[model samples]
Target: MIHSTININNNNGNNDNNNNNNNNEIEEINTLDSLSNALKSHITFQILKDTFNEYSKLIKYGNFVSLKHITTGKYLTTDDKKYLTGSRGQIVFSTDALPEANAIWKINYPFGSQPKANNEIVSYGDTISLQNKLGKMLWAYPNYKSPTSGHVEVSCYSMNQYNNWMIEPNISNISTKKNSNEEKRYLKSEDKIVIWCIELVEH
Candidate 1:
């Protein structure tokens, strides 16, 4: 899971205030208009590569993967609720203390891009999209700034480049080593991974 910053002065000001005052409690709001997450972020299952080969390397196209935040152990989730902001995008956030219904994400290539005819295996550095049960895909808006980090805003939108992500292994925070020599290795569920490009990552 990732961080969706909640400004103390936003519409959920009262909840944010309570989160600050209450040490052991916080609201779980996950909409753009009132982004307050006490749970998790949009993440992919990641296990440290030091023990990568111990797991099955078979994450293929059309697989339903619940990306678990390697650090927080949270699951990436979203809903059909639209953002009240100008983009009116679907809300993307992290939740589920464990992988649950809201955390399930479908894996696939870009909607109109060249399809993989023979290989269904997802390779390292492949550009892919993660779709939720509501049919919205994970999106990162480079044009919009996040309310918290002043970086690109990550949400669930459509099947465009913004939604396409390049995945790699052994990246920082996720792993300390990078196997650049390994031209293309099959990616498996729970394999510590990094999704970059406009910063849609959970490393």
Candidate 2:
């Protein structure tokens, strides 16, 4: 359901089998792995789905998505906070009322798989990377100095464990009489149902 564009340039082997041959041009292969990796480095902007769509498609591997701070109504922004004068940058929620270019992020699944559908919401596994448009990743550094200490920052994409984050829907904004725990679980399961329906339709 979620359509993502992935550009893969695979240079496996050249046409010439012998080393002396200059015409051994490398062939380009398109595979899931190549697509996934390409998606990581090539995602430049936000890829939002149509609001009118009934079911939310599971975000494909390497697709760009925006993270909206539920309470602030602001999107996650990159390079808003700088720890050092010339340091890479830090991640912060934008103060602007509307989403901006810096707020766009690419969801990176280091394990190489698509985000699973939980109810209508897409669930990234235990850990995922939120890579900003600037090619830096959102990182949370704890045990550091003040302000920057225990705060989110952006660093060069290194597939670091600290950069991994668990993304979940903000249930606090959901208005319901049900208990918080119950509501969260219900919503997740409901999303699963929506995903199942979409699967059925595809089949």
Candidate 3:
């Protein structure tokens, strides 16, 4: 479920203390009402939307599974990177143990301009894109793997040539030291990449 439900229960006090217990119950009800009203504010909705959107986005383009190449149909082990295109729905794998997928998971990346060094040449809302880029890069591996244990450096480039670097807003990078088995060796056919839900195979 997207959210958990809240529950409240009432308790009856002893006969000798019935009056006092009733007063306590009233106070509890007032507190609950205040909390409910506070949660109804627009700010609350925005926070919920933003959090859900980030999670949805992460799951979409971030399914790091035992992917089977469309052309070669070969299976890859961990630490491999394959340049993928099309929605996540279009990609299929041979093994089971896949992470949960979502329909609205879109791969968000900045491709406007960037630099060779790890410095920011352009700023788009202060590290939001950087966080987003890092999230996408995290998908290069399964959740069972360790992130802090090793070094993962992702850098952005201009285009398929890997020569001309894009400006700040436009960011692209490669996942270093991937256990990638099959490499497409070509850029995706479409300009934008998307992730969608597909059938899972449990092995």
RMSD of 1: 21.9
What's the true lDDT of residue 76 in model 2?
49
* TM-score-best of 2 and 3: 2
Output the lDDT of residue 118, model 3: 35
1-203, model 2: which lDDT tens digit per residue? 33445334545556456654444334344567655554456534123223223233345335556554444545446554555632334535454543444666665664454556422333423356666566666665554433443443434443544576654443333212346565422122122221121111110
**On lDDT, who's better, 1 or 3?**
1
Candidate order by decreasing TM-score: 1, 2, 3
Which residue pairs overlap in candidate 2's backbone?
A: 15-24, 16-24, 119-190, 119-191, 119-192, 120-191
Q: Give the range where candidate 2 is weakest over 10 consecutive residues by summed lDDT.
A: 194-203
TM-score (all chains, Cα) for each model: 0.56, 0.43, 0.20
Q: What lDDT does model 2 reach?
A: 0.44
- lDDT tens digits by residue: candidate 1, 1-203: 43354323235335545555533434445574344222223222233443464433457677677776666666767766766663567666666553444567778786568867533767777778877655777888777765655677778765555577777786432322247764456675557775321111221
- Local distance difference test, per candidate? 0.59, 0.44, 0.29
Runs off by more than 4 Å, candidate 3 = 1-33, 41-76, 79-94, 98-203
